[model samples]
Target: MYSFKSRIRYSEVNERKTLDLSSVINYFQDCSTFHSEDTGNGIDYLTSQNRVWLLNSWQIIVYRYPVLFETIKVSTNPYSFKSMFGYRNFMIQDENDAVCVVADSKWIYLNSDTLRPVRVAESDIASYGLGEKIPMDYKQGNIILPEQRVSKEPFPVVPANIDTNHHVNNGQYIKMAENYLPDQFSIRQMRAEYRSAATLGDVIYPEVALTDTSCTVCLASENKKPYAIIEFIS
Candidate 1:
């Protein structure tokens, strides 16, 4: 498992001094910075060399929440890695080893130069081994296609949502989904599938479907064209 110590920041906690959902997700991501080198070369350097790692999905479960000013340990290990795609598991815990959060992830190997998926080599796989292997069985959420949902409200894409690629940034989807989720659901996990890209000045109609335990949300263009997808788990 990959591990590091933590110092919970005030900005990351809520009124209860506990971590917020977005902050939880962000810190969880920070725990898994998987660049090719520890020699000060960053992700951009690896991607610039045409060896990018694409994240496909994640299933995070939260138990005890971490509070501001608390010291914790964060760690992760490769889950099930094979071929073009790999999987991993992660956790955040107190010094006593009491887990505060858990996350399972699916990742894909991308040829930076070709922009295509590629198989992982055995030697490359060996570098990530942490120790024990969990069961190969992993929980995966099906990517809800954009066309599947029925519309509720229509909104235009604005300049604020646009990012470097001139497309609606991925985090914008979280903002949009936040509006549709129930107040009771703490939103422990979010699994999203990127189907189409949304650019600035585009209008999108968001659609949602609700179930007892889960909710499916999506943002699409006019005539029911799809832009983004989100699935919420309790």
Candidate 2:
């Protein structure tokens, strides 16, 4: 497993003084960076060779919320591997050892130059020494995975929303979720699936609604199809 220390700075927390979803992203990113280094093939090493890893999907289950400045140990371990993609399982625990968040991510290896997927050989996978090929059977997330339920008129696709590859940057979607949740309540946990890409001309209609304590949002297509699904648990 890989781990990192957290400093819950004021900037990292929401108005309620707890780590926000964006901070959660930072925690996982730090752990993943460590995981890569521990495996002897960090981002710098791979990117230098024109290879990059792209995120495909992620699921987060929150058990508790960490208050401002609360230290945390974020850990991650490789669970399974596919052809060009694999899964990473992670956990974030607070000072009391209570699990703050549990997450699993799907990643795809790509040729940075061509932006095309590539599979790593057996030797490369062994270098990580992560042990035990991920079984095809591991279960995660809630059943049915909470589908995207609604949408509305499309909005202008601004330049800031665009990223280096010309697609909408992912974190902006989290900010969209933040707008829906009341400033007083905190986001206990969240799970998101990145489906189709959103390009320059693509208009966006982010639809959000609540089911019980869970808030669901869907970035809908002009034709009413879904571009991505985001759900929050409180």
Q: Which candidate is the best by lDDT?
A: 2
Question: What C-alpha RMSD separates each model from the true structure?
Answer: 3.7, 3.8
Each candidate structure's TM-score, on Cα atoms with residue i matched to residue i, is 0.76, 0.79
Write down the worst ten-residue block by lDDT for model 1: 33-42
Tens digits of per-residue lDDT for model 2, 1-234: 667777778888876788777778767867887888877788677867787776777777666768898888887888677899978887888877677778777888888888788997786578665643322233465324344455544576688777655677666666665666644555666777777668787787777776667777787787757677777767
Give lDDT tens digits, candidate 1, residues 1-234: 677888889998877888776676666566666423442334665556566566666566777788889998887777666788877777788989888887777777777666688888765566555445433334655775534556787888899888544567555766777788876776766677655668878888888887777778877888777676778877
lDDT scores for all predictions? 0.70, 0.72
Steric overlap count per candidate: 1, 1
Question: Compared to the true structure, candidate 1 yields what TM-score?
Answer: 0.76
